[model samples]
Target chain A: MTNTIANIDKEEDYFLNLGPQHPSTHGVLRLLVNLRGEVVKDLKPYCGYIHRGIEKMCERNTYPQIIHLTDRLDYLSAHQNNEAVCLLVEKALGVEVSDRVKYIRTIMSELSRIASHLLWWSAFGMDLGALTTFFYGLRDREHILDIFEETTGGRLLQSYNCPGGVMYDIHPNFQKRVKECLVHLKKKLPEYDKLLTGNVIFKNRAIGVGLLSKEDAISFGVTGPSGRGSGFSCDIRKLEPYSAYDKVQFDEIIRTECDSMARYKNRIDEFYQSMSIIEQLIDNIPDGDYQTKMKPIIKLPEGQYYQRVESSRGEFGVFVESRGEKNPYRIKFRSPNLANLSALDHMVRGQKIADLIAIMGSLDLVIPDIDR
Target chain B: MTNEELKQRIAQLCADAVCTDTQDYVLAEIPANSLFAVAKQLQEQPDTQFDYLYSLTGVDYNPELGVVYHLESTTLHHKITLVAKTADRENARLDSVCELWKTAELQEREVYDLLGITFNNHPDMRRLLLDEEWHGHPLRKDYSNPQLIVDLIK
Candidate 1:
């Protein structure tokens, strides 16, 4: 009698710790879950287990070096992170990159976005017990990494973005390889839907589960695919059009279901949009310098600058305060992962424990990104 | 609404609120005590409905300490930046905006953990990135840890 709960027939809750090291968490994020039997009553995400104090570090590093540090935040969207800082520096400096540079950056950024989403799809599938998706998603992602490695020398960090433009010219095979990769991914993407999206078991697991209403998404400040899944329409690439985005033609995918399946479809559809963006610019890259010559040292006028980039996950904002110094006086990165992660509790409450995994998988959170 | 219109609307709401519309966002400096009221006006007032708090940070400038709140209107797609300062440096405090934007729950905790700026009425106020027994805010300009410091060159 003492061992069992007195109100088991009624309603009683107990805490279950997910982990600061579990594989399903995708990193060191520990989620404190309040459960009533098999159903979740509350979920609290405990972050910062891997927090490296990036903002504090950036406050000490020079402007150019900050780009490299950004690469470490959301490693999947490293190029996009680099672009955020570069845009801020460029705006502060008032230097215009050549059209060639803009085209190249946009193409590269799209490529990384696809790569990041693929990796997310892979890990997400694995999170939901579809281990085969790991092999397929990574198999296609490897080709994109090869392309990046050929040009940038680093696949993960890919610190190609600089203040005025990219760090180097695109490899001569950039266009041809990109076109070939597009051809392969186009034929292969539908196979993803066939394997997981259309599967009855997967659909049963995702549809109408972990519902996040549009209002709740906004109040939680969620963005990117997570918000788009709820019809939030906060895509920075379309709304603000940075780099060469305005010249390119692509649709901002939106789904009103606001369930785990909707979030799943959002990233899948983005792969098509990203492909279209790359196709529009593949052959149109202008002839010009890869980088605008810098003044040896970079500094900004005394002011506050904000730059938002559409990372694979969501809006990655960089807020820089400079008092006319080589290093920023204070640099704050408005991390999208943190904002998206904050809404997990609201989405998972009253859902089953297994549904929590599916919901968290659809959230597509990178622990490093959240921790940063 | 345009930046000028937003500035006018904010001015109409609070006579003492000072705003600087020169930067990308409509930046404003308001008294710490009036932070909750001004934040509510920015969120509930249909003309300036800033329903999103995308970013919240604490800044340590030696003797002075302050908080930065970046708000955005999801429907209108307009953004603004608000700053509130505490006269008490070591014991800095401000009203919490978690009720307005749920995202502030963790961000305010991070600010409190890193900069030692207390967010009063914060749902759960504790050290976010450090052990609960840890001492001193690591992000403060005067913060020094000889145990962790290393020479970059030499």
Candidate 2:
């Protein structure tokens, strides 16, 4: 894994731009790939195509308004991203949400993790030329979204988490539907191991396609399943638990193989973990208020605060500096996609160009998260 | 180790470094001139061994511009926040920590592109998000554009 990635005789290499519009990229991410025939001599990712100035927008908006902006950063982990801001505000003002809020937030976060991983699995299969996995993955993901729509009233961009706690109480059937979705996915996901994960073609394309050593994963600041694949314990949920994470007992998946397949397996195993978390907490959502009373206009005393949540992709951090005003003085979101994308050049330098797609797919990049 | 012990160890490493206890992390305001040396010690030292740079961001404090680096040890799991400032706003420069954390390669470039903070020894300090012909660092407080402005007064 510590193989030399020095200049590979660029005199004979040619350049190819993979995206800015390629479907395999997942968004308008362009990769400047230097290829010697089919083998990659070097790889450089060009991002920021979808930069919407969300950080700058946060400086102008009130604390509550910033939660909506964060939902756009990583739509897949919308609930968790919103939670990061809510947690930061709660910590700054010393506001304690009810036990009900804690359990509900944890449950929603896990549900979204499953939804996100399912979508990533679908796209990953498509990257390896197995389009059937796309349909199978999305079928399960839509059920999660259906549950989201029933509770949060938004399928994708859910601004459900507010300053104190969740914006609204869980729907009456939230538990029933979520349990059903979990049961269905729990039964369906293993079939994927046989159909896609066990397929010789898929295995051949992915097993050792890309290598991100534990050192490189840490040095590059890759988190979540991607970092876990390389055996780097960068899980914020485990290290610094917030909400009900400290209460739940779940295994942080880590694979020392440090390849594309390891990353794939990490996410698959995570699906089981996320479902188990929900199963443990769903039946016991403490009966209480959904949110703590917050002012219409929120203000924090001058200070700096940072909070991170384990989004489906990785660590979604909100770093805000307050000036005792409604709007924050400065805000910076430490997006996981950018940090994860940093590992690409090192991962695919010696592999073929086709492996680049497989590797990128395994990283499960949400480009909007990167561009933001 | 707790932050208090980490600060004591860092003080021994860099006698002149200003170590302040923040709510979140231990802040070590290293001198801009000795940033690289201090950073190297923080990375390679047995106790500190800050092998992971999770977040690197540039802050524009009007007349003063500073780089905020968040380092964590994968081995020990202790975290520290290192901040270095240069009052030279016209052509702000600091020694790059890209060699320490590979994640800084893209992140530092992003800071340079948006806030106009130059890294002295960065391998490739090109504009990452913006085109070659784009003008002004948009994230800076002084960089004005009517289209991009969100006026609080209005």
Candidate 3:
């Protein structure tokens, strides 16, 4: 059987389509993989399946209206997306948000980061056939969602961020609920390590798979945990502190291994770092108005404004080119997922077909983020 | 280097390039023909090693097409914005920096797909977000598909 298999396609490479609807893809991403037997010789990712022309739409919409569209780009990191737009508009208009607003935004951003990471963990575990891990991950994620729904009034697509500040003040129980959720997550994160991180089967499949060097990570513009895994210190939060990131004291998680397991471990360690950030800022929120006074009709000065935030997956940048109108001349989002996904083909080459799933899961791509 | 030093350095490097110290970043407007060379200098020079190309965007300036590149030096922690505009909109073309920064490959394709600006020497210069048979570049100001896009603002 082995001889016959080898003789059948000794020099020929076969192609396989892995996604566009497959469960492992996590979204509408299609990978055309060329395989020589089980080893993947080349991989090409075809995106834009969920392209809603968000950039084109932004040109037609006003400054305030554009915030909602950002939420749909990286829905998992919806708060961060909204904040990127708000920060851009605020900077363009020269509006200084109150300290209270800054602290609240930072805390909420960290909460959403935890929530996004949890969902990624659940889906990644499911992709690798660890069914029990999904339930464990989502069970802890619920507390964060509950906190979001209570304050932002939306579970997933929360467009809470406005140009001047958040849309509305936090709910009365926001602080207490956040503390409770943090307490719950701090206890539950250890269980996650025991379940998936230490498993012998997972280690064999993950360790040393999809080795992306530090040079490749920087060249491809891969940021967040995936970039940090390759020892590329590309954390926007640390480098260009936006919002209340300057006040927070948390270590930027970096792993020099440059493999799938390194990426996995980076994200796992980030859970503690995120929690620590939230813990520091949660109690120290100052007393002031949640929002500042702003003109009803928002129009940025005629110039280019760019703002970047450290989203859960990577650096989410909003570039606004204004023509001194209510609407922007051209708006482009430097989506982290798109940059991260661009590097997928480079990382997965020469690896087994099965390891592609592990590497992809480690990337934690949100397709709409890429498509937008 | 500070924005002033970087501006002077860039000015020295590219004689015709207009360098402005913007509020956020050092904005430099280079001629379309010399963009690739200036970018190469920006990347290769030890003092101005703008290794990371974070964002590449194509803009439709009515008759002229433009591409804006946001580059950063991870080692130096400074950013520079390069704007290159084509003289003719009909045949919108610019040099591809994918050789210098791999991030430009897909972004250039996106620019080509949406704004109709083709990147010369791009390995795979194909439509990214839109289909091949798509009639017009939807992001362009003049691109009007009455059947698809409704003029909500008007």
Candidate 4:
């Protein structure tokens, strides 16, 4: 047999357009990649296919009205975005939120973080070829969604977060139900570990797939678990404490491997960390007013305010420019997915085409988050 | 050092670069040419090791354009912001910070794409998110949003 399989004609370098439609690309993301046999030579990410110009649209809406819009940016972590925007607006307005409200917000945010990570781990597993993990992960996520639906009246886009505080007081059964979910989650995590974490196939596909050195990770602006996976200092619920995060006690997990598997394990450890935070906050939720009294029509001073919070993906930032109006003059979102996706070319430069999907899954690019 | 002492130090170091001073943070007005030297000095200072860049943003000051860098020291836990104001909107050039912080490369691309601010000596200051054929900077205040009306075929 010849070194190269002889075709009828000449062998041309094959180029395949992955998708603005494939499941692994997340939402409406297209990648034009050139392949040398099974190895990818070059990759160009084509985004903004779902661009709605949410920034421009926010300028046209009231500050309160725009929280609904932010929910759609990172649909999985809608609560976190809502909280971040609300925190900025509240800071601008100089309204002090009550302790009870703070605890509630903190609990909800941690729960949302767990849900988002579960979805990510599931998808990451599926991309590595463990299809059953995807279904199992979402099945757990569905329980969290039910809790969100019961409290916020929406599963994906919970406009539940307002400027002063949460939309309403938690229902009587909310705490009980959330506690039960936490218990269930704690019990379910070990099964997840057995099925996916311990599986050799999953480990081999992810172990050293996309390695980001610590310095390079920081330089490239990678954050959250991805950064922690590279041995960067712990950031979440620790540095820049928001809500009741300061009140909770939990260890920030870190791994120096800086590989795809490290990120996977970082997220799994964070799942347990989040559960610990949620359990502590939910049990000791103080009985008090859920929201502080503020003016109906809120206006911010003409200046610039920057707020940063640790979202499920990474450090999510909101830079709001106010012109002393009810609406923002200009609001810019520093999306984590954008930065994570930007590093794709660096990560996938020498990997095989199959590993490309796995790397993309590990980065967890929700296209709306990147394109918005 | 406190903000006052830090201000005094910066004022002495680059007398003309001190734009505004506050108790918590200092805002320095840096020229395009002197930006790199000033940034290097800031990193070298023993007390002030602004090794971490918190955020880099662009501001559309209409006729006068500007780019701002919010810098912080992880060890010191102090923060400072530097604003590089440009006189000519047509040119709107500033020194690149990729040397100080590698994160600035993509950030500079974002500022260039959204605010139409150019960075001198930037490695690749290409359009980041939007298409290259896109007509104007969408973030500019003057960019208009046109309303489209649909005609029913049925």
**Per-residue alpha-carbon lDDT of model 3 for A1-372, expressed as tens digits?**
899988886677889999899899988989999998899998888888999999999998998899999999999999999999999999888899999989988988898899999999999899899999889988888888888899888999889999888988999999899888888887888889899999999999999999999999999999999999999998888998989999989999999999999999999988899899989998889999898989999999988889999999999999988899999999999999989989999988889999999899999999999998
Structural similarity to truth (TM-score) of each candidate: 0.96, 0.95, 0.97, 0.91
Interface RMSD of 3: 0.8
RMSD of 4: 3.3
lDDT of 1 at A290: 91
Candidate 3 docking band: medium
lDDT (Cα, tens digit) per residue for candidate 4, span A1-372: 564556535656778899978888867988989887788887877777887878879988988898999999999889999999999888877788999989988888888999999999888888777889889999999989999989889888888989898888888888889988888888999999999888898788889888888877766677888888988774846778988888878898889998888988999999988988888888788988888877888887887787788889888888876788888877888788877776777788779999999888887778898778
lDDT tens digits by residue: candidate 4, B24-91: 25777777667788887887799888776657877766666777787777668777878777877666
Q: Comparing 2 and 3 by lDDT, which wins?
A: 3
Better of 3 and 4 by lDDT: 3
State the local distance difference test value for candidate 1: 0.89
Q: Give residue A232's lDDT in candidate 3 (0 to 100).
A: 94
Candidate 4 — which pairs collide?
A: A19-A30
* Stronger candidate by lDDT (1 vs 3): 3
Off by over 4 Å in 2: A1-11, B146-154
Residue A179, model 3, lDDT: 89
Name the docking class for model 2: medium
How well does candidate 2 score on lDDT at residue A192?
A: 89
Query: Proportion of native contacts found in each model?
Result: 0.71, 0.73, 0.65, 0.23
